[model samples]
Target: MTVRLRPTLAALPAYVPGKSVPGSIKLASNENSYGPLPHVLERIAAAAENVNRYPDTNSSELMDALAAKFGIGSDRLVVGCGSVSLCQQLVFATADEGDEVVFGWRSFEAYPIISAIAGATAVKVPLDGQTHDLRAMAAAVTDRTRLVFVCNPNNPTGTAVSGAALLRFLDEVPSDVLVVLDEAYHEFVTDPSVVDGTTLLERYPNVIVLRTFSKAYGLAGLRIGYGIAADPAITMAVRQTQVPFAVTQIAQVAALASLEPAAERQLAERVAEVTAERGRVTAELRNAGYQVPDSEANFVWLTNGPAEAGGIDATAFAAGCAERGLIVRAFADSGVRVTISNPAENDKFVSAAHELRA
Candidate 1:
């Protein structure tokens, strides 16, 4: 036995993050156009003086603050470098060799790859009409399935399942099979039917809500995020599995300050702006000969399909847009996924769409 590793880890592809160009407007990664608060920057600057010291190994202060804010106990929550890291940890905790992880195809790109890395089989259910079909996803479950990830306002597609449908699906899934509701974009949703992960967690014991400060909080550079779970076992495993002092001191301070009532109020206004822009920009794209979907997240989904659900491919179209200086994500043969940034940049995207379509 020379060097045999886990087959799943050996076979999985590394995650490809959106590339950053020097002068190009990056709409590829779903980052907030608005920078972090001036106060957060100040806190970071102050913390930089203590670079020689290790971070709080337990992140006691940050966890306590999050628990109080979310109305969950400390035992129910765990923080990570980012929500993506929390995702990898969740798979490690719940899934074992030969276990299954179910999710919608073309949803979050990381779900399948991370599932494989955790020694679990990834069961990718195809999306129905660019949305997560709750019934179909729920039905895909087998006894071997250990975890199910529901990306609310599912990434790339930006379509979400209705609250009623989600409630029903939760009831149908096995209580033992952990259902991780990835609500990374929950801050930008404007629709009434969409489920709020914080509120939903009160009703579902097995549910683990994953959130990030990278998006609406405008702390992408800090890479701070957390998981909200009801059980102590999961949280304990996560706290132990994580490397010592992972979340930096500055991140803890910034995140805690951002959770203040005043900051939340400000965040609400920013969310309103994004929601409005998403509607406006999506309509403009549709008017410009693009087949856009009814996106409820802080992004829009466009298809160069329908006329040829087999005709002009979306990846090719995305590549064309990249050539024009606007970076958009193309999901293979499926449509393109554009993450909505700020109002000014959205206008630029709309202008680019008109130029390309015209």
Candidate 2:
């Protein structure tokens, strides 16, 4: 007889990752088009020699580096496999069965999935325009709310909420609830008014700021990210839930190497290039008559669905781009998200979009 799994587990929606088609320019995932820096690669290579030994379970050196960089005490930080893993850990740490985890509907696909896995109820507030509706999210919180995720420069949409709006939302949230500011794409953010989650930690004891080495640091394959909290107890709870040896030795060393001045300068240059390309691509798409949102991240959003383009859905648009050796993320009937890469790659995607319109 088949073993019975929990009904919730059986029904959980699988996380859909961006497609990687061989020989195609993949603008589906918002990864830094540029790969890891030379120094980071060198450190990773050095770390490889010690593979026989298990990784430092605590990722002590990496944690120390992060603590120094953020000017926070080591006790207040928890490094994990990735920001996504920390998202799960947060849910497990605070939410129990029947408790609620609130977030924006299309913010991050992982929020709802992680909440469901933890047996917590998922409460998704709809976006205002293409950005987060912080007020609506604040209103959604009830006594049963244990956690909330606010994806700044939200994934797939690439729209960010103003710093003032976020502060207002924080003021309204209850002190007991844990609010996570998921800033996976923080490095790519160019907006001056966007809330830097780290800046608010001192003021909000319940706030947790999540950052990743995946995007701008170009270490997506290494799977290392961290969460910062003013409360050491909250960090402890997240640490307790993490899988042992989750952060690899190579990932730890590479992350440390990335903090070096030269490597940081190089990464900053790459970010500048991506940000410039983002503006160019957005302008081009707008000129092409698509309703593209103002993107602060390394991607652009096309919110007009099938009806906007004489009944051409996001899936069809994606498929057309695929035929032309370009891959972009499409959300069922909702919209399309295309990553801004180097100029040549962005040109290919732009050409694909123009062809699809024809």
Candidate 3:
């Protein structure tokens, strides 16, 4: 007889990661094309000597480092394998069967999957102008809504909601329902008007802001991220659901090293470079006649999908880039998300786009 698996998983979609083609300039994963900072690499190398031993289950050193960097109490935080892992933990800690988890439809792909795995219903609100429709999301909440994820500077689309709009949405959401502001791309954001989730923590005890070392810190391979919550109870709940030793020794040391003053300054300089490249790429794409959204993150969005007006087939575009030795993330018929890298890499992708148009 076949072993019985949870029937709900039948319709659940598997997370599709960005493809990697050797020798190609990859902009598919929204990764910092610049790898780990020098000091972080040193820490990782030093920690490699102790791989035989288990990682610290509590990730105490990393936690303390993050606490000091953010100027918050350690009790307000919980480290996870990545912000994506924390996404799952948030669902596990708050939602159960018959409950609902709310988020934007195309925000983070993990939102729906995590909800399904936890046996919670997914409530997805459509974007307003390629950004989170905060009002619609707040309206989607019901008495059974246990968790809400707001992926600021949203994935794929790379559009962010304004601070005022977000605050309004937060005001409308029920205080008991958890609102997780997934800011995995926080370091890449340059917009002054965008909502910095951490700033709202004191005002909304229900809100938790998620940040990651993966992107700007150049530690994507290390998979270290954290959540900041005003309520100690929420932090406790998330920690309780975490897998023991999920953050490895190497990852912890790398993250701690990244918090060093010199390392942080270097990271900031890199972020500035990415931001400048983002503007250049966005302008170039728009001049080339693609409906590119205003991105506050490390990537730019091309809203060319079968359903979008004057939309180009995103898969075709991605294939074209692949042929030109550049890789970008394509969402079937939805659109393409391209990471903003060094000037030369960005120019290469732009040239590919022009070639595709030709």
Candidate 4:
């Protein structure tokens, strides 16, 4: 007889990351094309020289920097290799067999994957139009639901929830249920109505706010991110679940140095530049007859629902872009998510879109 196994573990679908091609403009992962400041490079180099020593298991210094930056107490801060890892830790800490994890469909592709890995049932609520339907999401709650993920601006679509709407949603949901406010792209948003997630951590004990250094900070390769919350219990659970010395010594040094004054100014400037570029790209797409919601993130999502543009299917569109030395992320059959990496790549992508027409 064949040996029995944990069916969920054996049968779970694998996570597929965006492709990387040599010498191609890769706008696939929503990473910052603007590299980090010069001082951060020096810090990374210095940390590299100390590779023999293990990283601090608690990552105390980086945690102190993060706490000071966000004004959150150090006790409530949980550092991880990436916010993605924290996402997994959060699920493991709270979810048990038969418990349910909820998230909007087409938000972060990782939500369901993490839920499944944790042995929890993944409940995906469909998007209303192109946005996350908070009312529908709030209504989908059941007694077994222990966690809900809210990614804004929602991944692949780039639509963010309003401050007022989220406040109401929080009030409506059960206070005991943990809500993860994944704001990986929070720095890119220019909308006036969006809530400052860091501030919300002070007001909402149930909310765990996640942020990364990969986007505006241009540290995707470094793999440093953090989770902020008011609840010591949740933060402590995540800290306990994290592997010892999970974050590299280089990552810790680079992240701390990135929080310095000049580095932050550089990030602020880059944020303004990228948001403007995102606006420009969104308008260009809309002018070409594609419907788009206001993108509050660095990437733009193109829909191909019941339609095709000049014989260009969504997959074909992405493939065509790849052929032209551009690597835009394609969400097969759903749409294409194009990252605004830099001016040169953005121009190449725009050229590819226009060229595909002929």
How much does each candidate deviate from the true structure in C-alpha RMSD?
2.0, 1.3, 1.4, 1.8
Q: Can you write out model 2's per-residue Cα lDDT over 185-213, one digit (the tens) per residue?
A: 99888889987889999899999999999
- The whole-model lDDT of each prediction reads 0.83, 0.90, 0.90, 0.86
- Local accuracy of candidate 1 as per-residue lDDT tens digits, 100-145: 9999987888998888877788998988878888899899999999
TM-score of each: 0.94, 0.98, 0.97, 0.96
Q: Lowest-scoring 10 consecutive residues by lDDT in candidate 1?
A: 304-313
Q: Give the TM-score of candidate 4.
A: 0.96
Estimate candidate 3's alpha-carbon lDDT, on a 0 to 1 scale: 0.90
Q: Which stretches of candidate 2 lie over 4 Å from their true place?
A: 306-312
lDDT tens per residue, model 3, 21-88: 88999898988888898777877899999999999988998888888888999999999999999999
Candidate 4 off by > 4 Å? 1-5, 306-312
Q: How many backbone clashes does candidate 3 have?
A: 0
Enumerate residue pairs that collide in model 2.
none
Worst 10 residues of 4 by lDDT: 304-313
Runs in model 1 deviating more than 4 A are 1-6, 306-312
**Alpha carbon lDDT of residue 276, candidate 2?**
91
Of 1 and 3, the candidate ranking higher by lDDT = 3
C-alpha-based local distance difference test score of model 2 = 0.90
